[model samples]
Target: MTDFTHMELELEAILHASNDNIIVTDDKGIVLRAIKNSEEFYGEPSEKMIGKSVYELEKMNVFSPSVTRKVLEEKGEVRLLQKTASGKTVMAKGIPVFNSDQQIVRVISLSHDLTEIQQLKEEYEKLQSKVERYESEIEKLKKRETPLDELKTKSPIMRKAQETLKRVANSEATVILFGESGVGKTLFARAIHRESDRHLQPFIDVNCGAIPASLAESELFGYEAGSFTGASQKGRMGLIESADGGTLFLDEIGELSLDIQVKLLKVLQEKEITKIGAVSSRKVNFRLIAATNQDLKKKVQEGTFREDLYYRLHVIPVEIPPLRERKEDLPMLSERFLHQFNSKYGKQTTLHPETLAKCLAYSWPGNVRELENVMERLVIMSDQPVISPQLLLLDSSQTDEPQPWMGIESFDHQGKTLKEVVLEIEQNWLLRAVKEGRSTYEMAKKLGTSQPTVVRRLKQLQSDSK
Candidate 1:
């Protein structure tokens, strides 16, 4: 074969091998050739498409607003979206080929089916809308007049705690909040920080129990670069250092090891922090707000916690009473949570009189956090505008009795195995526990298993449900 003919054949092979649908047209927008993929995208065979004018094709609606015509009009590269005769969407890019004279000779059109991309784009838009709505709600929540503005109460005990919080908010004295888990200790800490002079500064929270014992020190007191194996190339700033010129609220402070307790005491006393693997200490001016559900005095007596640290943190002690102790606040707290969740889920739901009565009567072991969770669940799960008392998932204020079965009943097993049935029951149990404000550690303790196992099971249950 002639060399020019061989080169032409090679070009044809290259065009055919390309994944993109390719069409080449003369400067006048008349198709000269089209690849096999053109039929898949444009619903027209290559042979039939050749020698056809793109303008004519446009008139026939073979492809709307032809990319070839666009490139010809612009005398340059053009990219556009087009709908094929079969109604499939495609993204097309047309590039003009120029000869030595700098005049347009041919136009090469490359297109890819946009059906999947369009679907993905639509899905992304929906997800983005949801994220934006959630963020807007979060911003509204943050801009509230006061963090404790939502802590509506009539109880003297809660009022006393609030009084103490307000009295010491501006003071630099270390404050310790002693309460049961879910009693809104963190909320009180945030309220204090917001009311303090450092309200404009950051409020850094560190969960001592959440971090592993091995990495607790490094996480609290950041290390320098190459301080240990697997350290970040840039030196890390510890949580304490990050809270400089702000307030550092350490939740579950009793979980800290004795060694960490000693270093923390130094920080409280000296108003400075020494990072791990560093010689010199850096001065950090931050107010400390430590909280714990455990009795630090008992922990110190048991030698699990240091006496000096206890004394240092116990300067302005605030005890937040649990929900069961202050049942008068239940109605207000429940109403607030209901409104919040209703706004979140785009629902207008209300508690039935009986449902409200049931909620008031229950001895909530999980406190305010649990009540919030229960309200959210009711908002999401209830079909009626007025939620009923029958919808209450928790047992009747009796902790000794087994939890009532709330799942769908399968009488004949429906051809399911025992394992599947057992798994469904277990998953339901775990979900209810989580909705009751039970953390992984709390769930593990109740289940007599490890925290990691509870987490894994919960994750598996979530995945299966999804």
Candidate 2:
């Protein structure tokens, strides 16, 4: 009837106006009809989409198992997650339409774009990962551990640091790396240099502590040809001059004397350095990366370090944590070192579960450097394919062992030889230290001795007579 046909046309038009994407396909999976909403969703005209295969429009569906033509033959209904050409996620539901003979004639599919929802989800996950990563990274940084090497966790820490570095790389601001020793301050300085626009220019590193007071000025600002008795005939380029249009890393900057600090502050403020015995000053266009393990605030309070210089260098303070606080990263760091040492030592040695457990238990006082050395030693000295605590000579070293000295005395102490008594004490301490995750430095500090002394004592104890 004319009335029935009019009603059907009206219904189709209403469905086409709906926000959901509506598509009609023949039983063979060929697109037969597409609603106006579908045209909007696919960013394609309805006329073009009607004649094309739905699979042809979606390219990323090759790996999906739900979009096959066999689904229409086997199942009367199917639901799947699909992505559009523009990488937008969409949820699609398909249902078979039956004819008068109770046989499937066409399949009607409705789609709802989930791009915004999925993007929100992804953003939330990224934020959560960043929070965890920074927390982990800050903890690791405090302990002189590189999150990249230790946790291998990708978050926004390094990315943000890189961005910050970019923002200030060309500026003349003094960037002081406030971190513990062995925290890769020099590497970060190099990174800043490499990322700067002056990447091709010279990059020089000067250890302020290593230079003598008499030579510090000449070494930094250069000297005239006949400045001193031992000076070269031709004036040599100092670190500052060598770093022209580039970067200079002044490591252990806290060790600089008051006079040098004053002169350095002047150079930073004036953007010029006067060489020793030079009548004139040379304008230096370079970035300064100052690193120090000492507490500048305390040094300032003690009147040893200049407050103005401290403020100048503290413009962008990058603090690096030591290794003990980022214990969660020990496993990854250990594995990396294991792999590296395995290759370097020409051994296929793998860490034993117990040894790994010990490594995690021990606090990394010296951070990555210490961990690398320990792994190298283990790989070289270990005999078995897999390293075990027994092979590490850790029976007396607390590298792996449980402590039971809280309450009762288990070992016999009566009439024991002096060596035996010392051995028992060492064993107990080592066990306790392992449980506490105390590094050699911590133990040495607590026992009032240097790290080398503690190491020597541990080695001697390991070689004790059983």
Candidate 3:
């Protein structure tokens, strides 16, 4: 075969082997040859396009705004996004064949379907949107989650109170904490302030009961220079002014006199406060969190506490349950306090089960404060590594009388002999040992007997009981 014939055959073979649609057209855009891939790509047969001009094919909508037309007009390589009536898309690149005279002779157009690339791009966008949505949800959940790392609460009631505290933390609403004395109401108020938008600002804590009634007004609302005989010449900013843009935790609110209550109600209503001798009132913006152990409702009926002030401060009421009702949290609480006091006092003291049992059995009238104080005392005074029941020192009355919880169950003889009664007592003590996982030496120490004797009696008792 001649060189020209061989080249023509090689061109035909390459066009057939190509996966893309290839078309060779003259300078006027008359189709000379085309690979027959139109049926799959654009729902048109390439055989029907071989003899037609690209201008006629463009009118037939074979490929709108043809790449061949662009190459012919521009006289250079060009690319176009070619689409058909069947919604098929392809990226077509058109290159003009240059003659020896630097003139365009032919236009070679190659196109590949863009369906896969389009689908991949759409999938990437969808995945990115989902990732952003999930991140936003995770951040919201983190904000809602309890700060259990510092303040542990196992009771549902206490946890619900914490949830309420989180919900109203950012708003400028007044929160009133109702609970018995030593129920950690002050701590919850601090938590509310810590989680609020004004966390970086000051948290002014005031115990209304601790302050003397004579100076309560001047202490809360500040005083001007020479406002009183003993007042400083430079004047003073009280707790209310000092807590601007932050939180003012009024602890023991029930202790405030009726006169101070009226002034506080006016402050809550107007959002401003006046000094003792200042003519103009200064605007104050503070989040109020009041705590009281006294029954304010009864106080109001008795004409001691102001009813209007009660309603203002009672916007969000969160009651903290006393420790007695939440004894299930005792183990965690005691362990935490034990660990804390041990670290503080440079001691490695551990709480024994029997010692904890004494704590659990006692009615903690003073609540968590009492429990905390007891633990602190144990850590400081107890010399041994393990704290025993004798070292509990719970109450003076407890020392005087026998606690029923600490003693064994009382059983009737039921006409049985003394020997059977003594055997039953032994069984009760052994049962306690089993539950406690006590070693023979430990049992002997408790029983004031030898280890071998205790071991022999344990085996004999097990056989007799069976």
Best by TM-score: 1
Q: What TM-score does prediction 1 earn?
A: 0.56
Candidate-wise lDDT, in order: 0.81, 0.69, 0.78
Q: Output the better candidate (1/2) by TM-score.
A: 1
Q: What is the alpha-carbon lDDT of model 2 when measured against the actual structure?
A: 0.69
Model 3, global lDDT: 0.78
| TM-score-sorted candidate list, best first | 1, 3, 2
* Candidate 3 or 1, higher TM-score: 1
Per-residue lDDT tens digits for candidate 3, residues 1-466, read 9999999999999998998989999999999989867668656787888889999888988888799999988888998898875577789999999999999999999988897897787789867855664465345434533342357665556767778888998788889999999988877777777778876566778999999999999999999999889999968778898778778889999999999999999998899999999999989999999999999999999999998898998899888888866654666778767887999999998766556545655667888888889999999989999887688766634321222223324755567688877776665564344333335666567667777776676545433422
Per residue, candidate 1 scores C-alpha lDDT tens digits across 273-376 of 88877999989999999999998889988999999889998899989999877655666777788888999999998776446545655778898889999999
lDDT-wise, the better of 1 and 3 is 1
- Provide C-alpha RMSD values for all models, in order: 22.8, 22.1, 21.4
lDDT of 2 by residue, 271-347 (tens): 89888888999898888899998999999999999999998888888766655544434556667778777887788
- Per-model TM-score, in order, reads 0.56, 0.51, 0.55
Error of model 3, residue 414, in angstroms:
44
